[model samples]
Target chain A: MAPVGFRSVEVALQAGGPRRTKASCHTLMEPGMFIYTETPEIQKLRKNIVELVLTDHPLDCLTCEVNGNCELQDTAARVGIRKVRYPDGENHLDREKDLSHPYPHFRPVEMHPVLPLCAGLR
Target chain B: MGTPLRVVVDEMGGGFREPVKALHIGGPLGGLVPMSKIDDLSIDFESFASNGFLLGHASILSVPERFPLVKYLEHLFAFTAHESCGKCFPCRIGSVRGKELLQKAQSENYQIDRELWNDLLETLEKGSLCALGGGIPLPVKNAMQYFSEELKPYFSRG
Candidate 1:
């Protein structure tokens, strides 16, 4: 189960007391913990992130190799980036794609300690 | 400082020349000025601050007439992104985004919103953890201010 309550740092430490092994205790285990507060600045930062990613991206959403399984697409959606800030002509689409690698690709979630999510690059 | 100091300009072709339009000082992120403003400007701290330029430890980048100022700014951001330490949130992400925006603007022919661009620049300038992130926008803004007419062809109303 996920932690749903909070105590003072002092209280929490005391509660864990002598019985606590490193594995026995943790902090801010909730998925929403450390959530980014959406200020105007944060919103701009997010928009800029989308703009940057799309610069090299072909934006071939319908025909991409990853198609519905792309992390870049998901990030764009989550950030509410409805439109790219820059023009599409500037993307360096001349670079060749390398598809010969045999290894399976997955984006490892670096979110936190407990639950990790993986999006495969197939 | 302005009387004795000499400005250097470099064309992308790896040759250095005197400023045809503006002289870039203080590395890639430093302020730029038109050649007409050269004698009026000084190289001292106070003068640099007042004129929106940097002393840049005698480092000067001479951009010729045809050199794309916007693309140069974009590359500066790219370099900053590559060198960022990743310890701070703003610098790590902001540089990457700034690089992208510049690329897109160049690619799209500058059809982007002016307000949005300014806001993002403001955030990077204020929030970056180091000079790498914060200072990269200086030259960009300076270019826009002094070279707006030259850059207009790269933009559209929509």
Candidate 2:
């Protein structure tokens, strides 16, 4: 029988092409294309990215932080999104800084536990 | 039963053996699944979930809109309405309210306070029929709970 599976991370990454998945699900992706095999050098890069994103600056950069724990940095350190280019300005949202809440009523960022998706209003 | 709901379950013959049948089995999202493959005439739930090709909830949701946000409730609920059974007032009404509240959330409309959206939720939850009316609140409620920062501007003290 043909092996059937849930949509693989690799297949989704390929089908989405880039511009589609990049906007929302950046974290859920697997970065096997970035690093084919796990090596010592690759592991070190993964570690550094995790410490910076998850440990050192968990609440800081990246949009994924808002929905509680990030899947990207988690997987990055685990699988390796550490394929760094010196010229990595291909970052999607450059003008993200300008957008901000205007008034006195805005809430400051607060940390919280990640909640599971609702189990269908039951 | 008028017509049996087709359910497909795949079995791994390596030791674990369980046989299940479905008078009316459905996919994870309450959508009707096509039961194309049946080995011995009985539909299997475990097989469908385990080995069956995963259906695309996120992909289907993500298709109409560029992004899922406070803004896309209309698109989202459009999907729901077609999917809705139209049996109860709550589902029929709740889905309509979902579009409105989502729009309100997106535009920062009204005061974004308890009175406006809360009343809508209360009505839908208590009054709707079947699962559709009841289930309509999940996405809208999620946006309110999770995306409050985006909604801060709309809240009103008065």
Candidate 3:
């Protein structure tokens, strides 16, 4: 549950409380509990959330590396976010990528082969 | 906890020497109550929540008349952005976007789209993983409700 609003399972277990916990996609439906996943309100929330994320994210999906394979792109499409409603403002899309470590170097170069052999022996 | 707000401010803390506009009770994620309502409110969770406010942490911060409410709202958003643990998307991205929106409104006299602003608030309130992102909208909404006149310039005409 990535965006579960409930603090814990105990909180969710409480029923008819003054402040009822907002259920996430992964919240299990129990007996006597009614969960509406596809209500109009939920649909609107889904779209709005996608739009909010898009407001800060770069909109250069067409030119981006993970254009088709991106989860965000898929969610945006699913939610039918036609436009990002927020006005133009500051964003981190244009920030320079930190390229200090171009390639990762492994330590103990000679031990690499021996380690694999040791693992195989085990 | 049932102590009157006036008792807390005037009696215990020694009343403000200067004119104050509002009281930001409960900390950064708390409710912002205008002076007019201060007399009716009490230092209790139910009292605050009944009026669309929060009694979080029970801390009080006085807002002076000279301090712009819009700037205060911007600071709340900025604080949210700074403190977010980046464990979730809505808090991490939404906080930064909200701060940016307020910055543009303050600097360029921009009028943010009303529908979009509500949408952002709803997302933060409902989609965040924890209270850090969820509770921030409480004070911002309070400002929109109680200090509407001051925030009028920043909202679109529609």
Clash counts for all predictions: 4, 8, 0
* Model 1 CA lDDT for position B110: 48
Q: Give the better candidate number (1 or 3) by DockQ.
A: 3
Clashes of 3: 0
Error of 1 at B128 (Å): 0.6
Residue B16 alpha-carbon offset, candidate 2, angstroms: 35
lDDT of 2 by residue, A1-122 (tens): 12221111111234334421111111244553231223443344333323222221223434543343544434554655443211111122322222233322111121111101111111
Report the C-alpha lDDT of model 3 over B83-138, residue by residue, as the tens digit.
98765556777888888888898899588888778888887887777899998999
Off by over 4 Å in 1: A1-122, B1-19, B108-110, B156-158
Error of 1 at B19 (Å): 6.0
Q: To one decimal place, how large is model 3's interface RMSD in Å?
A: 9.6
Using TM-score as the yardstick, the better of models 1 and 3 is 3
2 or 3, which is superior by DockQ?
3
lDDT of 1 by residue, A34-113 (tens): 33335554555555545544555666678766777976677678768777654443333664543344333322121111
Q: List the residue pairs that clash in candidate 2.
A: B8-B44, B9-B44, B9-B47, B10-B47, B90-B128, B91-B133, B111-B154, B111-B155
Model 1 steric clash pairs: A87-B108, A90-B107, B9-B62, B10-B62
